[model samples]
Target chain A: MNAGHRSESVPNASRLRIAVLAGGVGGAKFVRGLRQVAPEATISVITNTGDDLWLAGVRVCPDLDSIMYALAGVNDAERGWGRAGESERVSAELAAYGAGWPWFTLGDLDLGTHLARTSWLREGATLTEATARLAARWDLGVSLLPMSDDPVETHVVTEQGTMHFEEWWVRHRAALPALAFEQVGADRARPTPSVLGALASADAVLLAPSNPVVSIGTILGVPGLRDAVVSSSARIVGVSPIIGGAAVRGMAAQCLAAVDVDVSAAAVARHYGARVDGGLLDGWLVDTVDSAVVPELDSEGMRAVARPLYLSSLEQSAAIARDALAVALG
Target chain B: MNAGHRSESVPNASRLRIAVLAGGVGGAKFVRGLRQVAPEATISVITNTGDDLWLAGVRVCPDLDSIMYALAGVNDAERGWGRAGESERVSAELAAYGAGWPWFTLGDLDLGTHLARTSWLREGATLTEATARLAARWDLGVSLLPMSDDPVETHVVTEQGTMHFEEWWVRHRAALPALAFEQVGADRARPTPSVLGALASADAVLLAPSNPVVSIGTILGVPGLRDAVVSSSARIVGVSPIIGGAAVRGMAAQCLAAVDVDVSAAAVARHYGARVDGGLLDGWLVDTVDSAVVPELDSEGMRAVARPLYLSSLEQSAAIARDALAVALG
Candidate 1:
C-alpha cells in the first residue's frame, strides 16, 4: 500500500520532478513556495480551468494567471489576486456599460491577459496554447499547463438556480448556499497532453492547499485525469486546505458543507481517502494544530504528517513545501 | 434643381432636424461645431463604419468612439482621439502579449468601449444596437447612427497588397501610397434603418470635413445609402476637407492622389459634383483661401461659398457651420 514502494525515491531536490494541481491565490502562493524550496527541481503546474470564464467577451483564466503572476513576481500579495499597481479604469467603464459583473472586477493589467487569451482562442488556438503564450511573457520558474483545452466551467446549483462558480464565489462572496457543484463539460474534457506527461514523468505529485471542491476537485474531475494521478508511478500527496477546524483561505468550509463533508483536516484527508483503498492521497499533510488526525490517517494506510501550514511568509511556505516533499519521498 | 426648392424650411433651430455624414477626428470636430451653431436643433449623425475592426477580440469603432468622446467632452484634444486623462497600462501589457496593433494604442478608458461593444455583439446585438448602448452612457446631444449595421471596413489597395484602412492610416501613416480605397462590405451593406430614417426626416444633410476618399467615400459607397441622401427632401451640403490646394487635415491629399483627383477645393467639390448632374452634393463650403473656386463651382450648377474652414475654436466652427447651411438653404 506504500506509494513509495513502487517508485525510485527522488532524495535530492536537484533531481526531483514534481507536478502540482493548483488553483488561484492559495494554490499560487503554495507553488511559489515550492519553487523557493526546490529552485533546481522541474515543476509543472496543472492549473484548474474550471474558474475560467468569459467576462466582456474576453476569456479570463483565473487560476492559471494567479500562478503565472505569482511566479513572475508581478502578483499583488496584499490584494490576494491580480498584479500590483493595477488600475480599475477598464472595469469601471465595463460596469458603466452594464457588461461584466460589477462585483467581480478585472484590473487593466489582468484585462490584457484576458484580451490576449480570448484573441488567440477565437483565432483557433486552444486554451493550452493560449496559456503557454501568456506564460512565455514571464520568466516563471515553473511551466504552467491548463487542466484541459476544453471548457470545464464550474457551476454551483443553489436552491434558486444554477450560477457560475465565480458568481457564487465573487458576486455573492459565497453567501449562496450551494446545493451541489457541477463542472459543466467535465464529462467530455480530457486533461491536456502536457498535464498527463507531467504526471507520468513526475517523481512526486502534490495537491496544493486550494479549494478541494472547485479547484483541485475540478481538475481531478476531468475524464482521464483522476485515473492518471491514481495510476501514476509517482507518489501522490495532498496538503489539507483546512487548518484546525477552519479553511486556510477562501470558502472551502462552505464548499465542504455543500458536498456533505465535515470541515476538518482529517475529514478532508478522509474525503480524498487513501490511494490503496482506491482514492487520491498516498500521504496527507495537515496543520500541527490537527496532529490528532495524523495517527487516524496513518492507521487508514496513508502516510500523514502535521506541519505549520500557514503561508504567512515565503520561508514558512517553503518549509511547508519541504515537509510535504519529505512525507512523499519517505 | 436648387436644393432650396424643398417645400418646408424650418428657419428656427429648435424645430430643425439635421443629419450629418461623419468619420473620426475631422468629422467629430465638425459635428461638435455644428452642435454649437444649432444647439437646439435635433442632430442625427450617420457615422462612417469603414474604420471598424476587430482588435484583440473586441470591436473597435474608431469613428463612432471619436464622435461619442468629442460630444461627451471626454475626448483627448491633444491626442486627436480617445478620452482625456487616459492610461496606457492595458496597452503596454497588450504590446507585451503581442495582441493588438503595436502602433495604434488604445487607452484604458477607450478599451472599455471596445469591450462593451464586443460583449454586446457576441451576445447577438447588431452594431447599431451596440452603438446605441454605448451612446446611452454619455449625453451625446446628437443621435449617433452607424452608416450601416453590416460591416463595411475600408481597405486600401497599395502597390504591395490590400491592407485595412486603419493599418494604412495609423500604422503606415498613409505613406504606403494607396492605389485605391475599397469599402470591403459596401456592396452588401445596406444603410441602417435609423440612418435612412434620419436622412428622410432631415431638413438638411451636412457632410463633415472628413477624408473624402475613405470616410465619406466609404459611407456613400454603402448600397442604396447615396440614393437615400439624394432622393430625401433634405438639402445635401458638403464641407471641403481641402484648403489652398492642400488637405485641411489627415492624408486627404494622399487619398485624393490615389483616386487621381487634384488636391484642391474646386477639384473636391467637382468630385462630389452637382445634385443636378446626379451627384451627391447640392452645395459646397470651401476655405476663403480658395475663393477663386466659388465662381467655378457655381457655373457648374453647384452652390458654393468661401469661409474660414479652420475649426480652431468652437466659435469659428459654429461660424463655418452657419455659412455652410446658408449656402445649402439659399
Candidate 2:
C-alpha cells in the first residue's frame, strides 16, 4: 500500500462521516479514493451541477454522471470520464439530425442515464430525487447529492460571444480565453436539504481536486451552501487541484486565470481564504513540490499541509485522502 | 409482369399529375412503385401523421419516415421499413433507462430522423417545414406532404383502456379487441395549403394500399382534407389493401373488424363508397382473386375493376400504379 500514514485502524474511523464537494473526473477519482480509505465512514458527495445542460432534449449532468460511474466502477478509466464499453451511436445520430453540439459525443449507454434523468425531471421529480433513483441502480458507497435541484448552467463569456461552459470546454477545448464564468440561475438556486444536512452534521468537509473556479466555486456559489460550511463546526479542507503550478487534469489554469488568481497552490489557498478571516477553508492541502509555501499559508491563519498529492492509483489517492483527513482532524 | 394493361408508353404519361393519400409501409411501397413507373410525373404524397408519437421526448413520425426511407432507397427491404444496416444501440439504451416503449425497436438511423424533426420543431419550425428539410437530404423524386401541420394522434379504445395506436400496434401486436380508433386532434386540424392545392389541381388522385381505419381513414378525418378531395375535379382511384379476403400487410384486418367492415376488397370499396354519392372513391381496383365483387361495386355507383394489385416488387408496384391511373382515367 502507498499510504504513508494508514488511518484504516484509527479510532472512530468507521464513524467518521466526511462530506465531499466535487465536480467531474478529478473529483470522482478523489471521492473513489476517499471511499476506499474510509470504507465504513458515511461519505456524502455534493456534486457541481453548473456544467449540466440539455442536449438533444435530454438533461445531461456530466459531473453527477462522472462521479456516479466512477463510484460504480463502470467509468472508462482510460478516457477519465463516461462509461466503460460505451457506444456513440446515439450521439452520431443526434449529430446527423443536427440536434446537439456535433463536437460533443454522448455514448449510447451514457444516454440511458440522461434519458432516465430527463424523464424523471419531466415527471416532476427534483434533480436530487432523480439522482437518488439513478444511484440506486449501482452500489455507490457514497450518498450522491446535487448541490441544488434548480438549473444552474455555467456560461463562459468569450471574445466572440457567450457560450455554455460545455461548448467552451468540450467544443473549443477551452482555447477561447474566457473573460468570465457566469453561473446562470445560481443566484436563485438553494442548497438541497440533504446537502445542507450533510454539511451541518459532517465531521469534516473535503473539497475534491476539481476546477476550483467552475466546480467547487460553483457549488460554493449556491445560496447558503458556503455559509453552511463556514458556520458549521466541521473543519473544511480543500486539496489543491493545481499541483506543481499546473492542473493535474482539465483546464483549471484557464479558469483560475479568468478569475485573476495565480495558477499556484498558495494563491488558490489564499483565494479560498482562511476561515478565521471570514473565508471558507480551515485547512489547505498542496503537493510536496510546493512545500515552501506551507509557512506562508500558516501565517495567513490557514493550516496548510504538503504531501504527495498525485492520485495516480487508488492506493495513492487513499494516501492523499488520509493527509486531508489528518489536516482536518488536527 | 402481372400488369393487365401496361401504360408506360401511353400518351401524356410524363405529364400525369397524381396526388396520393398514404399511410406507412404499404403506402410507401406503392409510392416507390409509382415513382418508378412515372419518373417524370409530378407525384404528391399526402402522408398520415396519425401514427406519430413523442418517444423519449423526440417526435417520431413513423409514416413519413417509412415513405422517405423507401423512396430514398435506404429502407430495409427485408423489414419493409426503417434504414438498412441500422443499429438499435440508442433504442436499447432508452429501454434500459425506461424512457421509451421497450417493445418498439427504433433503429439508430431512424432515431436520427426523429432527432432532426424534433430539433426543428422545437426551433419554431412546423412539421411541414421540418419534413421538407428532411426530404431535402434525400432525392425522394416525389413531393412528401403531411396531411396536416398540427398534431393528430391515433388512439385505440380497447376493452382495457384507451391507448396510443403504437402501444396497441407495437406493444400488444393489436391482439386486444379495439372498440374504436380515435383520431385525436383531427377535428381541429386543417389541411396544409400544399395538401389542399395538390387535391384541387391534381389530374388524378390515388388512395394507396395503406390502412383504411388508421391511415386513409385518419387522413380523411382531418377537418378539411376529405372535403377538399370531395370538392376537387380530379378522378379519385383507390387500390385495395385487402386481397383474397385479408390484408396484404400489417393489422388492417383488425382495424377493419373494429370499424365493423368486412376484411374484403368489396367491403373496403363500400367503406369508401362512391364519390358521386358524397363519398371519397370514384374507382376501386381490387385483385383478380376478388373479381366476384366487381358487379356488386358497379351496382353501388362505384366503378370497380379486378386486376393484380399485389406489389411484391418495384415492377409489380409500378404495374399496380398503372392500373390505378387507368381506372381513374376510365
Query: Which model scores highest in DockQ?
Result: 1
CA error at residue B142 for candidate 1, angstroms: 0.6
- Please write out the lDDT profile of model 2 over residues A35-143, one tens digit for every residue: 7777778899999999999877778999999999998999999988899998887677667656677888888788778877887888789999989988887899889
lDDT of each: 0.88, 0.88
Q: Candidate 2, A70: how far from true, in Å?
A: 1.4
Clashing pairs in 2: none
Off by over 4 Å in 1: A1-12, B1-10
DockQ list for all candidates: 0.79, 0.47
